[model samples]
Target: MKLSLLLFFTCFLYLQILFSQDVKKQVEVGIIEHLDEFVPSDIQLMNEDGKMVNLKDQIDKPTALIFVYFRCPGICTPLMDGVADVIQKLDMKLAEDYQVITIGFDPREKIDLAIKKKKNYQSLITNQNTDDGWRFFTSDSANIARVTEALGFKYIKAGTDFTHAATVIVLSPNGKITRYLNGTYFLPFEFKLALIEASKGHSGPTMNKILQFCYSYDPVGKAYVLNVTRLSGTLILSLGLIVFLVLIIRKPRKRNYPKN
Candidate 1:
């Protein structure tokens, strides 16, 4: 009787634990948002050529940062294809305004593999005018962590497989994340809107980047705005100029009285 009772209790505990897990999963699903605000400024990673690169450095121009493993036969290839298609459909003027940077998630993948994948993607996107916009890179674990951690992108390695999200981040010319495209079904309108938003309605970061030296792309406004520091300085300088002008204009005029 004692043995039978112990077995029954064990089964009951298992059921309770299962139910608790179900509840936790339900909560997680309910709480999931579009993205969890992952933006990294100082994060740096090594390129396939053994050169160091950072997101901040890319802020000089608008770059589409995509994360995927070169070996992914399922979602990654199609995801990349879809992005290529989206870029191809864009008008030439719009296409030239931005750049695409693809990073392989698997550090084990070598530069040759990355180069091959890049070549395949290039074949899919035939816009000769925008050829320069696309790039592929491989990096080590340290750089990957710096980037993934800052962007709130997470992944799990189970045996030989990886579980990760299908997402791409559009950063302003200044390297700040302006928008995130999630899932396989990416719409051209959304991508265009995000690109314009990132470009800040300037049509692209033609002039603002040099003067401001910051990563900021506002998709809605469609123009690059000054970074916080530059914006502040501009405001202060304007105020000072106004004060100086008032002093000059209001300076007491010398009395024009006849010589005594």
Candidate 2:
């Protein structure tokens, strides 16, 4: 009876190990294909000039994307304002290397409204020709849906409010998501760092990136962060070590038990 029980438990443990191995394999596969899966699609979006433009064709260089509704009274307005403040503080030469794209989530908004918003932001920038670097646009529902889907942006319209991730996504010149800044407001320093990292130090300030690397997330500060995948992996590894230690400590006791 004892041997039968042991065999049953052994088989259960073996199955558990196999299942875990399968899960780990799946996770590795996911990580391996993450970049390929996330490459932005060549969805057509309308330009400020009311021309139908393909997103991939519009990229003269790397770009940052902000998702918002033009009429958003709560988060979107201040979010854009805060981002504009950061852009204002950046040196013009460094800022010229990248473009800022504001995509309105509201389908009713026309290209004229988008052009107005672009002009508003342009007025805020201290440097001339910031318009060449910064841009804004609104697209029809279909194109907006396509671009947001590509970027993994989920939103629900709640009467007068938009319930969505208040985030900014940084994309490579080839339109791959490099880093995402969560929350409506972001620190200029962290934005600068992410830009530098993306540009490989040929664009944004290197010294600022180094100085700001060690700072952790502050919810009130609305700072950018490393993604949750890193945190979850650390947690899983810690739990694995604890389980291994517990098994090692229990093995000797089980071996020493009297044969009954």
Candidate 3:
């Protein structure tokens, strides 16, 4: 009877966990990272000049791909601002060593708004050539879905606004996703590192990292924060060694008996 009860409880707990995961999957509204995956060559978007341009064709250099609607009233502005600030800060020349492509995910958005938005941000930059380096686009729902899914950018349309996360997806010259720089703010060191990796077509995964994971750059604090988990683990190992050494040193030594 006890064995049967135990099995029943185990089955019930498993079902509850599965249900929770399924619900979470349904409302998952942020990036579902597809590391090292190549962006689809066929996905196309309309450029600021109202020309249909293939995404792959536009990515001839290390690219920072940003997705936003021109009319978005939330995180989009800060996101674009973050990109602009980083561009101004970094020594790397824009559109030469790397390029930025901002795609409008709202199907209803058109070229005119895209062009206006591009000009707005371009004006914010000082002495930087915005004509070629940073470009913007508008895309239909079909192409947007294709590209977003390819890059694992998930969003849900709520009323007139959309729910999404602020992030920059760094891609190599050949359109391979190399790294995801999260949040509206960014650090120059990590940003440069990500671009360097993207330039070489390397994916910085979470578990099996290709670039870095231990020493992450903190934008607010303006410092590189070491991983606490890794640090604690190291301390535990060192503590064990110290304890063993103390035991060995304190241990009583055998005394020599002279012809007792």
Q: All candidates' TM-scores?
A: 0.60, 0.62, 0.72
- In order, what is each prediction's RMSD in angstroms? 23.2, 9.2, 9.8
* CA error at residue 197 for candidate 3, angstroms: 0.5
Whole-model alpha-carbon lDDT for candidate 3: 0.79
TM-score, cand. 1 vs. native: 0.60
Give the alpha carbon lDDT tens digit for every residue of 56-122 in model 1: 6655565677888888745677778877888878663433677888887787887788878877877
**Winner by lDDT:** 3
- lDDT of each prediction vs. the true structure? 0.61, 0.62, 0.79
Q: Which candidate leads the pack in TM-score?
A: 3
- Provide the lDDT at 161 for model 1: 52
Q: Poorest 10 consecutive residues of model 3 by lDDT? A: 207-216
Candidate 3, pairs of clashing residues: none
- List the candidate 2 regions with Cα displacement exceeding 4 Å: 1-39, 92-95, 200-260
Per-residue lDDT tens digits of candidate 3, residues 1-260?
46545755665576556544543553345566788899998998898778898999999899998999888877789899999999899888898988888999999999899999988888889757788999998889999999999998877786787767667999999999998887779888888989999999888964312112333333344333566764565466557656755765687888989995
RMSD of 3: 9.8
Candidate number that wins on lDDT, 1 or 3? 3
